[model samples]
Target: MKYLLLSIFLCTLLACTPGSATKYPYTIRDFPDSLRTDLRKIVNYGFIGSPSYESAGNIRMQISDNDCKRLALSEHPILRSLALDILCNRHHLDHYSIMMQHLDDTAYVNWYYQCASFTFITVSDFMVKEYKWYTEEEKNRTVEKIIRDHNYLQSAYEALHKTTLTEAHYPFVRKMAEKETLMKFRSEALLHLAGYKKISDTGFLHNALYQSRHELDANAFGIMELYQDPFYFAMLKKYFPGGYYRNFCKKDFERNTTENALSYVSALASYRSEESAAILEKILFQDPLVPCFPADTFRLRQHLYEVIEKNTCEHYSKMLRVVKPWLERERKESAENGFPIDTTSFYQFPSDSTNPPKIRW
Candidate 1:
């Protein structure tokens, strides 16, 4: 019994040692002391009435229940950054060092933006203000930091995926939309600005949206459907008329460089215009870029069809018009492969998923 107790004592001692931290996921023990300290501060999420909870400055924020989950449990590296992203956003704590640095690996940046907490921060920053947290000094400093990140351009852009611009940020997005050196980045800024529904300078937007000389600028083309400006239609008529929507750089999608074209498709579905239906139809037949999409071609087309159906009153004509061209293209393409599709079993959206009759693949 005495020997067994000694063995247990030794085991506990070893586990508590600094070297043991590596045994935890994410090699947490190796993390810098300061980083760990910051994590500790956040993981210690204050209770509802506890002193750990930060009171408001000019505003009080009732952060969502989902957002209130404390991050103290997980020791993963990405989760640590996410915890920081959430807790800092909730408390209005400043200094987003890890995610802002361009030198950081793709895993950290991708996860930081991909996580739910970051989305909340982006959407909530503006949303909660309608009801808001943080000291005046802290809020000002945080806003200043955001401006600094914005000035950093690409770095800021990556981080912005995990954050959103508030009313004050509308001006920043507006200026960037017009003055940014790169047309693609300018288009991105334009999209961000448009989300606020406040861009009034049609002349500037038209010039930026159509002035691009590239064979395909996803960022610029990406925003055309949202604004749906007559100028965009004029530009589309000259460049792509009668449902010709195939200029997304497939290479960019493979490179994981940017959101690229699949994002363009997601945005396209929201557009109800006849032009949009034509474009969606072209891709529905076959998008070689399906690997980059959130879903397979079949599923994507199904969703697009549903969206178009919802948007247009002339659903049957629009569906037939779009499908006719796609079917013809498919027949030619399938003939080349010597394996033509059976048109008898065409794809359609199941308006009622619960119906057992519609469950066929």
Candidate 2:
């Protein structure tokens, strides 16, 4: 009986080995020699020395520093590059967040205020599709949080600025305003004073600050939709001066007016109005690149095609006339380059697998 059991166990072990039909398939390609060697060193130093290294510093610092040292001694170019990026990011976590946030904020303001309503709609659609990782509840909560924080910051700034405006606490306000650390405080105060009758009115003004606040809120929503997080915008504001936001918007307006006009054309195409379609053709004739931003251009054209498909033959004709040349050029380029052009659409809806599907005419 013991011999029979031992033989059964041996057979079971052999049955589970790779290439056996009973074994699940997995890919286990060998790592590059340099990467394999460095990986081994990292494991050895990280795990084996961890107990002794506990006295060193934070876990992040110790691991990154040790890994970097090992990478420096490594001869593999790719591994060295990867290690350097990891070390740099680990070392400058806050700085990277700040820079990315500023860029995002700047982009948000420009897209929100200057772009056509259709552009906003298309971009919003793109953002939602691009960041479908976040659950609906998560997205809603994040947006609400951002709005609440923005309101709080705006209120605080208004209180400080009101004292300055009345000259009651002018010197203190001036001093606080001069410090770079308190710039958001100062700007919010100034904005509050400029927009509101008094400190008591700050809440009311924020609640009803129709165009500017709404535009800002929309931009924030756009960012949240794209990134699935609100922390990025705060980080952006932390690094770049708030003054840059206004300046960036102004520059985008001046440089992108023609582009914006083209967006209007794309919007007309989507709406399938004969008047707008005629205007689009004129614009397309003048400048082949209408909506300059690649993402915007792709989205605009897509919406235009969708409108054509669902609405009328006129829209279909208009789209073909306007887009055929571009599509043909793209196809030729894709063929030459051996890469497929991506033209995909995404629609978002609640997932309830247990519920029956509903049909609509």
Candidate 3:
């Protein structure tokens, strides 16, 4: 018993040693103590309501220029991202040069937004697109290089968006749209071309949609929304059929499911046909209502009403028939729950029915 206790004591002591079982297990031996402290905070960042949650400013303040440069080279993608962010915050002339060092880093970083996060964005492609450090001339030259090399095509694709694309860029963008394996990159290229009204032939669009059978991503959906093609109405209906809608409205189907469902709804609203209206009517008025939280329910309704109101389809009035009574029921429910619904700012309900109330809060 005495020997066993001693062995257990030694194990715990070894476990508690400085480098052993560290929260950041990756070796950060090169950074100085103060910088290491800051890096530690950065390494553990993005947890909701945790002390590790760091804003950009807070991160920038602690990391020196020297420290940031070193951090930019970190094998750890998150730390490397921190270095890029700090450099971006500096707004220095040389920030772009330092950023170019890791422009090819395909290391995936999980980016957090409130409680939700996208797990797929690489450290290289995302943040650089957002910064405004490049000149119009510089942007053009860099985009040309990115396209010519094909090594940095993802960054090139993103840079294309910020610059005023010329005739020179269209072929490259279209080619990237054709060849890139990533759905987002392909869709993004298509979306960019569509934005410029350059997609006279939608063969590329159709092929891309066919490949994206798993889930029509946001950029692909953006194209459908832009063209408002009658053909995609049938496709959208097929993609978001009755079973999908039933699964989507449940409380458990929060997060990205909500966004995906809403995208389909918006696409449906784009069409002016009775078929489009019927799908929406079923969504808003049919059984198994959006059983998300009250706030989430409000959000879905707000989006539905705004889109329905803007649409000029013949079924608009038919679709809105339940609006007044629904609003009244919501008001009654709110009052009963001690959070009364205020004046409605969302839908201007048809005045034909005894002065319909608006919903704001």
Candidate 4:
């Protein structure tokens, strides 16, 4: 009789915990039938659609303050996050205490905001819901919390990166970029610094790039590309040796070697130097050392052409003249070969009804 009583007591305690199966149902059918219909709809289908903001906003409006508070008790992280959004955005209630309790809720939620859907942890969803209204001190504390907890770093940064950050936040961001062991977070921090254009240190970008390895290289190159500093011209040039961007000629398509080279190509193209132009001209015209399929070459050339067209310099005048005829020839060949012919110009130049403009380059 005592054993039976003790077993029931233990089961009751487990059922009441935050992540218990009874508290947080694994299936929709397991959720209590008594839940309000509107709240259930938000929890079940809120993450759908490409840009889900309109639908989500409408659903958020139907939740009452009382109903929204009840949602905070749900073990479903998405529903809990929805509750947080309602409390702050609709009712203008203080939900910081509730948010603190959910800081460790690492369950992923795909939230719709600003005409785009982003997948992030439940804590970040609510933090983002309330971030815009936070005072400076509150914002600082939020950043500190993100720094102290790795779980919040990526998702919180995604939601907060565009918010108005002043000079005071630079050091905190820089530390994460340089010192954080997680490359994804470090890369995000590096891009944040570049995006804000607030870094005071001259050597920071160079050092960051120098230290980057493997997947981090793409982001480091992206930072340099965004910075647009002529000082990195020599470093950019090193990537374009042997008439093509590094790794562009690799035979292994599975490794995506050529695709990965696009970042380096784009970084180099941002420079207007004669050396840069000459290298790119070779890339545009020369046959590869290791031949790719004709289709692959055409696609690669088209991508290269788009980058070149966008960043054309006086040095590219000769190359541009040669390119027009080559592209016209390719278009004719594609038509004869029964491939679908694109009506747009090879470089996607805007067409005029009569007499197209000469030399946009």
Rank by lDDT (best first): 3, 4, 1, 2
What order do you get sorting by TM-score, best first? Answer: 3, 4, 1, 2
The best candidate by lDDT is 3
TM-score of each: 0.40, 0.25, 0.57, 0.48
The top-ranked prediction according to TM-score is 3
- For candidate 3, write residues 100-157 as lDDT tens digits: 5556667677666454544456676655554554355555555666665543446766
Question: Candidate 1: lDDT of 281?
Answer: 59
Candidate 1 global TM-score:
0.40
Candidate 4, 151: how far from true, in Å? Answer: 7.9
Q: What is the lDDT of candidate 1?
A: 0.45
In the range 26-46, model 1's lDDT, one tens digit per residue, is 433444453454334433531
- Evaluation by TM-score, superior candidate among 1 and 3: 3
Candidate 3 vs. true structure, TM-score: 0.57
**Best of the two (1, 3) by lDDT:** 3
The stretch of ten residues in a row with the least summed lDDT in candidate 2 is 102-111
Local distance difference test scores for all models? 0.45, 0.36, 0.64, 0.60
Model 1 residue 102 CA deviation in Å? 13
Q: State residue 25's C-alpha deviation in candidate 1, in Å.
A: 39
Candidate 1: segments with Cα more than 4 A from true spot = 1-144, 148-150, 159-164, 181-184, 196-200, 213-222, 238-296, 315-361
Off by over 4 Å in 4: 1-100, 105-152, 160-164, 182-184, 196-199, 213-218, 241-260, 288-299, 325-361
How many residue-pair clashes does candidate 4 contain? 0
lDDT string, candidate 4, 158-219, tens digits? 52354565666676666666664456557777777776675465577667655554343556
- Model 3 residue runs over 4 Å out of place are 1-93, 107-123, 126-163, 179-186, 196-200, 242-257, 291-295, 323-361
